[model samples]
Target chain A: MLNKVEAYFTKELKEKAGILVVLTLLLLVPQYSWRLFFLLLLIASLLPRDVHRGKIKLMVSLPFSKGDVFWISYAFLITIIVITQIIGGAFFNISLSGIGWDILGTLIFSSAYFGIAMISVSLGFGNFGIPFLVLIADSFFGAIGNNWEFTYNLFRSPSGLNPYRMISPIYQGNRFAAFVFAAALLITAYILFERKGTSK
Target chain B: MIVKVENLQKSFSGKFVLNGVSFDVKEGEMFALIGPNGAGKTTTLRCLYGDLTPNGGKIELFGKAFSSKSKERIAVMNEERETFRRLTGGDYVKMWSLLYPKWNDKIFSNFALHYKFDLEQRVETYSIGMKTVFYVALTVASNADVLILDEPTQHLDPLIRNEILKVISNYTLEEKKTIIISSHEIYELEEISTSFAIIKEGKVLYSDTVDDAKASHRLISRDEKASQGEVIGLVGDDTLVKTDKDVGRFPKFEEIVLGYLGGRREFIPF
Candidate 1:
């Protein structure tokens, strides 16, 4: 069990660590911050595909249980989330000041997204899930990109967009959204990780 | 029994890659899966090692029902370069060894020594054959009764190929371990395989013991006048059907078959 877990981290997270750092640096560079969320989704989905690919042929031939799938996914997601948090905050300057609510949101987003990426890339045949994920994510990203200043007003940013809209005035709209992003990811990850695949 | 697959079936796009495939691997038996490209051989091997989930199959390993998640009894030598390029061969083995409950560094190092694999060098600098040797050592080090190998000989030199096969064959004989190997080299399989299965076009065309496969079919050839026996085999650039049999020395039969296979074909002249 420990070996599987370790392999999951090393293969899915550590193996991709360099890329993750490079990507985080890319996201932090002022103007390119717009690409951060979408890139995050893409990177998360890409990590485990190779390991899963190698295993897909064997898993289909052998006997696998849902619990095994869930654990594998969970293990992978945690590593990704931890890496994302470390890189995002330490280097990219993605803050986590007040908004205690943000942590819950981050955890959720991390879990959901980690799971989503796990299931999406783990598909046996085509890239059906990727397009589906991109369709929804791209549109949302587009909305945010075009109206970065506008969304600042809606979800009640900590303070940047609106002087008195939210209690934690120090929190920027992007910060709150990151937490929400984390929440969204968590919900999705758990669902995908738990969902029964067509195979069995 | 080391492993048992019951009523296994895997489908993609409504087509079954492995359909109702079932079998028992006796302890210490070296089994081979021989089939054409796109055959269920790789798929079947994947299912055995927890790399895939069968649409409908139950696997019992070491007297326990193995669900998709229950993988405490098997080891797999997967295809996509399991070793991290930056890590030394020894470190890679040790890293994985820590995770496996059944890992035995002694056995792994012994296999590495036998194979002449350099343990101190970074894995990425080595060739594919070297990586395979490292993977085999790590997997064997796990000491899992069941070892699932997919295309272990792909891209391997003849000498290395024989060496790996020798290790697997010898291990199964000396220890009561079970190995499932998928390969295109039917003749090499003939030498060491106790059981065999053939997959073609995403299905199990036939699966049985080596003796049964040999007994069930005959490889007869003709110069120009072919017999009426149905074609039941693949010969060079043609198919051998008994009913439409025009068996000539398939252009370059000996050279083509042996060359492509790395000299692993056993022909029965008829």
Candidate 2:
């Protein structure tokens, strides 16, 4: 599994880290703030089709199980998000606690979105398709009222309500509930990847 | 047996691509898989390498059930070269070496130099032919017990093609490696394969030792043939079949394959 992680790091995450840096730089500009969520979506979408051809074949051929791949990918993603958010917060002069809560809030949403993307990709939705759809749906739900309270509040950062907290927005829901939901989705994604691997 | 696939079955969208395909490969044999396009050759290789699990079948590698450990004993160079495009040859090889416990660094370096592979260059920078050569070299370097290559020589020049075959021969002879290669290159397979299995439309048409399969079948004139063989095809009144009685000589490997694919199934002997 370490070999697989190292492989993914060298082949993919190294480039992704550069992209995250660029995205972080953009976050310093107040107007481009919406780009952060999209950046997370981009990271979530990267797992399904990292290679142009034979992605599933290559993944399954490796010694590690699909669940291992999922967990490694998730860990890498969370690490990237945390690091980038910290950098962005420093540049934007946001409080450390504010940025920490913001990272935690985004982590939950990211995991949920990643899970949905994984399930959809396993169901043949291809990379980028499901993640992009989920991002749009999240924004749409955030725009409406309490109909999609879970998704709406998740996307709506409480920090956005304050002038100083503009760069780092925390979620409004029960933090534990969000974490539990993310865990559930992650397990679902793992099961889906396993099923897809077997189905092939 | 190094690899055993028993009654394998696979389907996509309610259509069976491979149905009850069964074959066994010995510990140190060069097994060839031959078939036309969409003939389930790739599917069979995928199942062997754990890329695609068989819906109903048992696949054993190294005397154990197919699992992550089984995969460690197998190295594959699938026809799809578009993967690993992001990594340089050096990085990819380094990663592969880490994946396999018994990686032969000395052998890998020797082949790397022989193939003129630019270790520092990204795979996407190489031409398609060069990429195939690099992958073949990498798989050999893995030093796994079983090598499963799908269309290993596609997009390669004749020179590299011969070189690849030579490397396979040396790998089998010197290291006692087992190879299960799927390719349309019959002449190439003829030169190296000890045994082979021919499949058509997801069904095994024939499976036997190369020498026996060739000796058991021949192309003879309908007017001169005797009884007890399956007629494969007709060529200008000459009937091709797998016969019990020996024709004066054996047919070429290509002749036998073409016979099985295009010939009539009925046995006709004069």
Candidate 3:
């Protein structure tokens, strides 16, 4: 497992370095929304492009299993997300005590987007096409829900209160639903990835 | 058997690419899957190495069902020679050394010396022949029990191509390893391959050991009528017939392959 991780790191060192540079530059932006959008774009572009470009063939041809490949990529993406969150918090002068919840919210939000992107890619949607469309739809719905009372009420917490509203405004409804949705998409993507031919 | 593929089926976008392909390789044999382009040779190799999951059928490696653990015993050189393009040859060696438990640095070094490969240069800069050689060298040094190489001799100068074929043949003999190679280079493959399966249009046309196939089949002249043998295919004006009695001249390995693959085409005379 460690060997596989090391192999991936060495193989993708250049791409990873480029990602880090772009991520750091994004963090420098004052707008949190813009930074988050670019971060999601980066995450969405990660695994799908590898599959599309037939890089997965090289990885599977080695001792690594398909599951190993998927989990390693996911782990690497999560690690990047965590590191960038920490860096973003520090850059924004957010106190360490106040950063944990924000980091957790970012993880949840990013995971949901990652799941969407993964399933889209697995279904033969190009890396950027469907995921970008979903992002646009999400923004459109969120904006509409903010203005319309009925739509806003549907997405609002049952208790009429959201403690993490500032962190995760997307999941304004039951957090359980958010978790389930993310889990379902991720599970579907995993199944599709495992069953689908890597020749694509 | 070192490797077994039974009734393997695969399709791309509803079109059957591998329509029930099957073959087996014994231990220490250089088995060749010979076919023209788009004949499902690469697809079969991909399925054998777990690069592509077959839509239906079974693939067994080393007497058991193929799985992730099975991959540990196999090394593959894909048709595309896919690699991390930005990485140098040295980087690949380093990465593979860590990944393959049995990787032999000495073997890789020897290949580098012989090929005069610059370890510092990225893989993308290498010519197609160099890249093919590089991948072949990597697979050989992996020290796996089985090697699945798709189009190993494609896009190479004749001298290097022969050298590569000799290296492949020697590796199987000296290391007692099983190799499943898919290629359209019938003449070269016939020289090295012990067993062969001729595939056409996603189906196996003929499969047997090189010696047995040659012994059982004969190339008869077009004018001669063979009443004692089953007609396999045509080679120019001559007919390739499977026979028990010595009727016509025994077919060369490539003649047999060509007869099987080209036999179906209607000979048009102007």
Candidate 4:
């Protein structure tokens, strides 16, 4: 696993360097909303880049399996997100203990989005198209749900409210339900990636 | 057998691309899969290496069911030659050395030197032929037991093509490794491949050892329609027939492949 990670890092050195620059710039922003937006953009684009470019087939041709690829990529994404969030919090002089929930929330949100992006890519949808559309719709609805009580209740009732609220700005929804939704999405994405024909 | 594929079926959208393609590749033999475009050659290779899961069929590698572990012993060079285009040749060596447990840097370096590759330059800067050679070199250096190469010698001059073919032939001979190569260079492959399977429209029309395939089939004059042996196809003024009787002259490997793939050629009256 370590070898695979080292190989992946070496292969993607240039892209990772560019990501570091973007991340540094992201740290300069004071608003969490903007930071989250850019972070999600990074996740949406970077996580599925290999699949979109048809490089996943090449990767799998090596000793690595599809499961290894998926988990390694997902773990790498989570690691980067956690590390950056910690740095951002420290740089802004926020207490680490107080920001634990903030970090968890960000991680959950990112995992859900990553799952959606991966599923889209595995299903032959371009990396940016479906995920970007989903982000737009989520933000639009999340905003309305936050501002309107009736709208929030309508979404929160029974029609898959937990998954939607996971990405919403309002933190009043059930966290457990959100976690289950994210887990389900990631599992489904992994299965699709395993079964899908990776030849390009 | 090193690789066994039975009743392989694959469909794209709603139509079938590979309908029950089957073949067996023995250990330490150079097996060739030759066919025209859209004959499911690349698709079969992909499925063999686990790049594509067949909708129905069985693939056994190393005398066991094909799995992720099987890939550890298999080195595949896909048709696209896909890689990190921004990375240099040196970067590939470094990355592959880490990925492949049996990687031999000396082999890769020797090939790089022989091919006159500039290791510092990005892979995208290399010509198509160079990229193909580079990928082949990497696959060879991987030192795996099984090498599945799809169009290994595509887009090269005659001299370089022959050199690549020799390198492939030598790899199997010196290392005693198994190779499943797909190619349109039937004449060139005929010299090196020990056995071959001619595929057409997602079916294996004929598969046998090079010696047997040539010995069993004969090309006779088209005018002399054979009363013995099954007629395979027409080749210009000749008819390719499979028979045990002493009739027409023995067919070359390319003739047999062309007969199976092209069949009877239709000419337009001008």
Best by lDDT: 4
Candidate 3 deviant stretches above 4 angstroms = A28-31, A140-169, A172-176, B264-266
Q: Which lDDT tens digits does candidate 1 get at residues B52-159?
A: 556787988777776544455577777555455456776676566655677897887677767788878888788887788777777677777778887777778899
lDDT of 3 by residue, B1-270 (tens): 988889999998999999989888999999999999999998888888788889999998889998887787888888887667678888888888887899999999999999999999988789999999999999999998998888899899989998999999999999999899998888788789999999989999889999999899998887888888888888877899999888879888989998898874766888
Least accurate 10 contiguous residues by lDDT in model 2 chain A: A161-170
Residues B1-270 of candidate 2 have per-residue lDDT tens digits of: 888889999988879999999999997889999999899999998888767767888998888887776677778887777555467788778788888878888888887777788888888789989888877877888888899888998998899888888889778888999999998888788899989998999998889898888778877877875466777776445677778787634688777887777766555696
lDDT of 4 by residue, A65-119 (tens): 8888888888877777777777778888889785677677777677777888899
Task: Report clashes for each candidate as comma-separated counts.
Answer: 43, 1, 0, 0
TM agreement with the true structure for every prediction: 0.65, 0.83, 0.92, 0.92
Go through the candidates in order and give each one's C-alpha lDDT.
0.57, 0.74, 0.81, 0.82
Ranking by TM-score: 4, 3, 2, 1
**Scoring each candidate complex against the real one, what DockQ results?**
0.20, 0.36, 0.68, 0.66
Tens-digit per-residue lDDT, A1-200, candidate 1: 56555654554454566666666555443332344364444444543354344433333322234454455655554454455555555554556662234334444444444544655654443323564454465445445423566664554445434422221111223556545554555456445543434232
Ranking by DockQ: 3, 4, 2, 1
Candidate 1 Cα errors over 4 Å, as ranges: A22-101, A115-200, B68-70, B79-87, B120-122, B202-206, B211-270
Model 2: residues with Cα > 4 Å off, grouped in runs: A14-18, A24-36, A49-56, A59-65, A86-101, A126-129, A132-172, A197-200, B235-237, B246-248, B265-270
Highest DockQ against the true fold, candidate: 3
How accurately is candidate 2 docked according to DockQ?
0.36
